[model samples]
Target: MRNENQGTPRRTNRFWVKVAGVGLIAGLIGGGIAIGIGGAIQHHEAVVSTRVPSGSNRAGGTKVNKNKADLNGEATRAYNSVQGAVVSVINKQNVQQDNGILGMFGPTQGDNSSSSSSNGKLETASEGSGVIYKKSGNAAYIVTNNHVVKGSSALQVIMSNGRKVDAQLVGTDAATDLAVLKINSANVTTVAGFGNSNSITAGQDVLAIGSPMGSEYANTVTKGIVSAKNRTLKAGTDGTLTSVIQTDAAINSGNSGGPLINMAGQVIGINSMKLSSDNQGSSIEGMGFAIPSNEVTRVINQIVKHGRVIRPRLGILYTDLANISAKQRQSVLKLPKNVNQGSVIMDVKPGSAAQKAGLKKYDVITKMAGQQIHGLAQLRDILYAHKIGQRISITYYQGGHVHQTTVKLVP
Candidate 1:
C-alpha cells in the first residue's frame, strides 16, 4: 500500500500524474463575468472587493438565485465569492520528438527536406488555473502548480474578466509543486484570501473554481465535500507530501493550480493532482488532492522574496533500501539479520555535510535528529526541519556496525 509520486519510475503504471495538458492550441478565447479591479496593489494586503450591481446576470444572462440554488448553500456562496479571483494560466513551449527505429525503416520516400521525420519541431501549449493571492504596487502575485509553468517559453494570465496579460515567473519550488507568477496589476480584480487549512474537517462542503479543460470552460465551478484531510502523497523519488487535502470536487486536468474554497469564501487548498485508478486499471473517481493553503503560503512567501526557496541539503544521493529486493539486500549490502530498512548512501558530495561527517558510500542512514528513519522520505522530512548551517545528529550503519555523528547542514 505504498504511495508514489506522479511519474516515478518504480511505479510506472501506479504512479500519480500531474494535471497539465499537451498539444494545446494557441490564442484560445473565452467568455466569463467581469469584475472590475481598482486601487494600488500592495504586498500581503487584501485586495479590494467590488460588489456586482444588483440584478446583474452572468454573461449568458442566466440569473442564479444565490439563496435558492439546488447546489450546496455554502458551496454556492463560496463559489460566487471567490470566482472572480480564479485565473487561467497559459504556457507555450517548443516540443521536439524524434522518430526512432520506425523512422529509419520507413517514410524515406519523400524528396522534400521540409517534410522529413528529422524535423520534429512542433508548437505546444498548455492551460491550467491560478489564483490572484496578492498585489503590490503595479504588480500582482499568482500562485499556481509548478507543472503548469514548467517548460514555458512564455506565460499568460487570463483574468476572470477575459483580459489576458503577460506574466513573469517570479519563482518556483519543485519539491512542493508550487510556483509564483507576477503580472501587471491594472487588470487584477479580486484577490482571494487564505483560510486556516488546519481547521478543515472531512465532510464539510467545498467549492472548486477553475478553467477545467481550458479557457472554453473558464471559471467553471464544481461543488463537493471534503473527502479527507492530511492525506500523504509522494512528491518525487526522495520526497513525500505529508499533508495534502483530499476533495471530491471534480478536479480535472486544467483545474491544476486552482483554488479550493471553503464556506467562509477563503482558499483552503490548491488543487494539484488526482488519483485516476488502481494498479488493476479500474476507473477511480472522486479522489482528487490539493496542497494545503498553509503550506502554500509558506512556500509562496519564500519564493516571492528569494526567487527560490532555500532548504538545507544533506548532500547525498541514495536509494530506499525498502524498495530493494531481500535477496539483493542480504547478498550485496551485508546488513545484520535483524536490519530491515534504511537509506543506503550512494554518493556524498565533496566537502558536503555528509562528507565532512565521514559518511561514505554504502553507509546506511538509520536515524537522524532523534527520529528513526526507514527511507529517504523520513530522512528528508527530518533534515528539512533544521535550518541551514544548523547542526544535527545522524545515526548510520556501516560494515554491520552502528555509529552516530553530528553534522551541520548547508544550503
Candidate 2:
C-alpha cells in the first residue's frame, strides 16, 4: 500500500510540470507579439519623420521651413505703401521768456510784451501727425487734427524723409476736428488714397501709421482689427457728438491725425483719440478711435471749397432731457411720464427754421425724420443727414401732448 501511494504522488508531480511548461511557452509567444507590434510602430514613425523636408525638422523639434514663415505679409505691404505719406506735424507758438523779476511782476500794464527785450520766440507747443492726401500744381495738401494746429503761431511738417517745411493752414473746422495744410509738393513722393469707410466691416484688419509720441518715432505702424463702427462719442466742451470708428490699434498722443489704413493700403479713417481710462479712473486698453474717412472726405471737401463746413442749422439752444432731474422734467418742463428721452429746447433763434416751424421753449424733441431722437447727439446726427433746403418732419412733446411738423432746413 505504501509503494502504490508513492507512485501516485510522482504521477501528480509530472502532470503539474507539464502544465508549467505550457504556461512558459504561451508567455514567451505573447511577449514576442508585443515586441513585434512595438517595432512596427517605431518603424512607421521613423518613416513619417523622414518625410519632412530636407532642412526642416519635425514639429516637436526647433528647425522650421523659412519659406513658409515670411514676415512680409499683408500688414507689411500695407505699411510700406503708406509710410511715405505719413508726416509729423509740429505746432509752434510764440512764448514769452521769463526775465526773472519782469516775468514775476508781469509786463507793466501798457508795456507791449511782444516788444520786450526778451522777445517772444516761436517754440514747439505740441506735436501730432498728418497724412499727405493730395498734390495739385506745386502744392501738396495734408490732413491733420484741428486740435493739433489750434493756437499755433506757426506750423511745420516733418516729411517722411526727415525734411522739415512750413505748412500753411488752408482751412480748419473745429466741429469736425479736421484741418488742411498746404506745403510745397517738391518732396511729396506719396499721397495716400482714401478708401470708402462705408464699406468697412467689424473684425477687418487695419494698420495705423504715425509718429506716436513725436517725430523721433515717425512712421510707427500698429496692426489691429476693427472693433466697432459708427460709434458716436461726445466731443469738445460744447457736448458735440462725433461719429468715429473704433479699433484696437495702439494710438498715443502724437498719433492723432494719422492715417488708419486698410489691407488695400488706403486710408479708411483718421486716428484721433484713445480712451485711456473711464470716468472712474480705471485703466482702459486697446480702445482707439478714428474719424471715418467718409466724414473726413466730406469735411475736407467743404473746407477746401468754402474754407469751412457749411451745414444746415436748426438755430436752437437745447439741453438733453437726461441731463435734467426727474423733478425738473415733471415740474419745469412738464414732460409726460412716457416722454423719457429727448432734447429740451431752451431757446430758438428768431429767424431760424425751428422758430418758423413753431417750435418753442420747453418743447421736447422726441423724433426727427421718422427716427427716434434719444438726445442731442442723435438729434444732431439726424439733422446733419439732410442737406440744406431739404424739408424734414419733426416730432415733439409740448404741453404734455405730442406734435409733428415739417420744416425746411437752412444754413
Candidate 3:
C-alpha cells in the first residue's frame, strides 16, 4: 500500500494507473452535524453547536496574534465574505457506516435535514461546508471536498444569510482533495478572495474558517501562525506539491473546503484534513496541514476549462543504485565517476518524454531543467512545475561520459 513518497524502488508504474482515477463511493456512515459559524453564512438544521471560549466568538476567531493586525476585524471580514455561500450537506438518502471500527469505509454524510424529519438509520442529513467562486456571470461554482459529496447524489447548499438551494457537483480532483459544484442562482452573494500562498512566511498569523463538527457555526474561526512553508509530507505525489503551507489552526472533521486566511482577509490555503486516529477526537499535538493556494488555483482553472487537471508526465521508472559503488556510478549521474551519490534510471518507457529527449535506459539522470535531480524527490518537482507543452533540459551520464538533452512534456 505504499505510495511514491515511500522511497522504495518501483518495479513498474502500475501504481499510477490506480492512483489517478477520480473516485467517490457513498455509504451508510453517519456523523454528528458540524455547527457554529455566524451571520456570514446561514446553514440548515444539521450543524454541530459547541460553545466557544468567552472572548473567542468573533465568528470563528482563531488564536492568532492579537498584535499582528486587527485580527478580529480580519476574521469578521472573512466571515462576512463567505457566510452566505456556505451550505449544510444533506445526506438523507445516503447510508452511513455503522458505528464500528471499519466504519470509515461506509458512507459519510449524516442527517442534515431538520432533526425531526427522521428517516431510516436514525439519521436525517450530515453537515458539511462550501464556498462560492464566481457570481452573477455564468453559473456560481461552490467548492467543497470530494468526500463531502460522495454518498448522496442530491445536494443542498446554504448561504451565509440563511438561504438554502440545490447545488450540482461540477467536478472533483481527489488527488488534491478538492471539488467544484455549479448552482443556478440569481445574484448569489459573496465570493472568497485568493491570496498568495508563497508569500506566507514563518510566524505569519492566519485563521481557519469553516463548519467544523458541522454547520452550526458556519464561519467558526481558529487562529495560528504559518508553521512552515513548502513542506513535503510523504502523503502524495512524492513531494509533488510545492509551496505547501502548514498551519496549526484547529481543523476538525467537517472543516474540509473551508478557507485559511491571511491578515489582509484573503485566502492563502484550504483547510483540507487534520491527522486523527480515534473517535474520542484525539489528534497529533500542534499538527495540522493545508493545501497551498497555488495548487488549488491550478486545479480549479484546469477543472473549469477542461473538466479535469492535466498533470505532465516524464514516463520513466527509477531505482536507487545503492548496490553499486558510488565511484562507478558517479559518471552515471553526470557527476565524476569518483563522486559519492545519486539515483539510477533503470528503465525508460518507450515514447516517453525522457526517451524522446535521448534519455536512454541505464543513463543516470543527474539534473532536470538545470535543477539537480538527486532522486525521485527532485525529479518529481521539476516535472510538476510545468505543463504538457513546456520544454526542459536534462543532464545524464552514459559510457563514462556526461551528456545533456532537452525534453518536451506530455499530459
Top of the candidates by TM-score: 2
343-378: candidate 3 lDDT, tens digit per residue: 577788898888888777777777788887555555
Candidate 2 lDDT, 173-212, residue by residue in tens? 8887889999999999999999999899999999999999
Clashing pairs in 2: none
Candidate models: Cα lDDT each: 0.83, 0.90, 0.68
Error of 2 at 29 (Å): 38
TM-score of 3: 0.65
Best-fitting candidate, scored by lDDT: 2
Model 2 misses residue 62 by how many Å? Answer: 13
TM-score, predicted candidate 1 vs. hidden true structure: 0.67
Regions of model 1 farther than 4 Å from truth: 1-72, 93-124, 196-205, 226-243, 324-342, 398-402
The alpha-carbon deviation from the true structure for residue 192 of candidate 3, after best TM-score superposition, in angstroms, is 0.9
